[model samples]
Target: MPIFVVERRFADQLEASAERLDGINRINADEGVRWLFSFLSADKRKTYCLYEAPSPEAIRRAAQRADLPADVVTEVSGRLMPDGSPVPIR
Candidate 1:
């Protein structure tokens, strides 16, 4: 699985506006995607989610179901470990 960073802008819902995020979480679970963590911007108008998904399309579909604006999605690439160790090859 690969990691993706998604930034979302939610619709207005007054006090219940926060529920949009809950919906996103549920959709992610239903899609078999893992949400490593999420953060609300200091301004409280946007959100950032780090997810492990099988593909970009899966994440996109999940976002669509949540009804949140998927403003941006990027694939993250990195070594298996933080230490710059050589990768084992067959």
Candidate 2:
């Protein structure tokens, strides 16, 4: 699977409830996509999500099914740690 960074912009502040997350996760699994985690902006109107999927198309499909916005999906080679060390993503 490949790792992807997804950017989502919501018209209003996002409400991340457990029920909503569970539903999203279920949809993601159906598309072979895993929601690793997400970073939300201070205002909560924007989110940067990390996902592991077979392809960007899989993520898009999951997002569409979940009624979430997948504004941009880009593959990341790895991550740079706070210590300035480069780490490989699984």
**lDDT top scorer:** 2
- What tens-digit string does per-residue lDDT give for candidate 1 at 2-86? 8888887766522334576577688988887878887887766788888899887888888778666678998877535568675
Global lDDT scores for all candidate models: 0.75, 0.94
> What TM-score does prediction 2 earn?
0.92
| Model 2 segments more than 4 A misplaced | 82-84
* Least well predicted 10-residue stretch by lDDT in candidate 2: 81-90
Candidate 1: C-alpha lDDT: 0.75
Task: State every prediction's TM-score relative to the real structure.
Answer: 0.68, 0.92
